[model samples]
Target: MSGYLTTHILDTARGLPAEGINIALFKIENGERQKIAETVTNSDGRTNAPILPAEAFEVGQYELVFFCGEYLENHGLTGGNLKFLDDIPIRFGMDDPAAHYHVPLLLSPYGYSTYRGS
Candidate 1:
């Protein structure tokens, strides 16, 4: 099997990649979140290593929590008390064990979106 996982973040509002951002991956079971992986983004808005290695990859539900508040602030964005978004949680499920999973987040201070990539 060659299953694995990867992710990246882009700051749409600033037209730059989101670096220095922290992301945590959690496995969900019975409505509970158990931390599985955590890392900070590199200069390219992606971790240097795979989020989930093939040896540990499995079919299950997972949640990715992205800390975007500090990132926005670092990029000179300030919303004081009216920020529309901060910590963003994206939930997804995996059922295939032999495929590659790339989840990329396109973001701004107020909103974000994601899609599966090759």
Candidate 2:
């Protein structure tokens, strides 16, 4: 099987899939953010497929931008005017391109968590 980069989003406050949330994957190059791909969470709060294929994975810094504000408002978890957080961005690194990277997000209107997943 080929290696890949994958992600999932879960709304801890509501205990459901964070559907419809927009997510972006970016690479940090020369102190600038270069977008690699963009995807919106499906009904299950996951990408349709792996975000990065083995051929695309590289050893470098990366970022995942989660559209938390819009997601909360759309799901009635928060009002549209809420400002606790807008687009929350998580930055991490891929030290080994040959391995799979599963980045899962556990999110709430007020906070979020992420870690290297299987």
Candidate 3:
């Protein structure tokens, strides 16, 4: 099997899947960034498909930017003008071309956490 990337978001404070969050995937090479994929999380807090499909997978550094501010605001979970958390970007490297990369975000209005998931 070849490598691919998947992700999801859970609203920890709400104890539910974070629906309708926007996410972007970018490949970083030579100190520059190039967008590879963009999708909105579904009702299950997951993209419809792999952000980086195996056919387009490559071994390198990548970033997943989660647009959390709008989601938080839409759900009435944010402050008036200043958001403690907005767009969250997670950067990491993919070294194996045949492994699955599952990165998930646990989010709240003021903070977030991520880890490599299976």
lDDT of each: 0.88, 0.86, 0.94
Residue 89 C-alpha lDDT in model 3: 96
- Tens-place lDDT digits, model 2, residues 1-118: 4467999999998888888888999999878999999989999999998888777778888999987887777767664565677798999888875789999999887788999999
lDDT of 1 by residue, 3-37 (tens): 99999999888888899999999999999999999
* lDDT for model 3: 0.94
Largest TM-score belongs to which candidate?
3
**Which pairs in model 2 have colliding backbones?**
none
In terms of TM-score, which candidate is stronger, 2 or 3? 3
Candidate 2 lDDT trough over 10 residues, lowest sum: 74-83
Backbone clashes counted, model 2:
0
Best by lDDT: 3
- Scored by lDDT, model 1 comes in at 0.88
TM for candidate 1 is 0.94
Better of 1 and 3 by TM-score: 3
RMSD (Å) per prediction: 1.1, 1.6, 0.7
Worst 10 residues of 3 by lDDT: 75-84
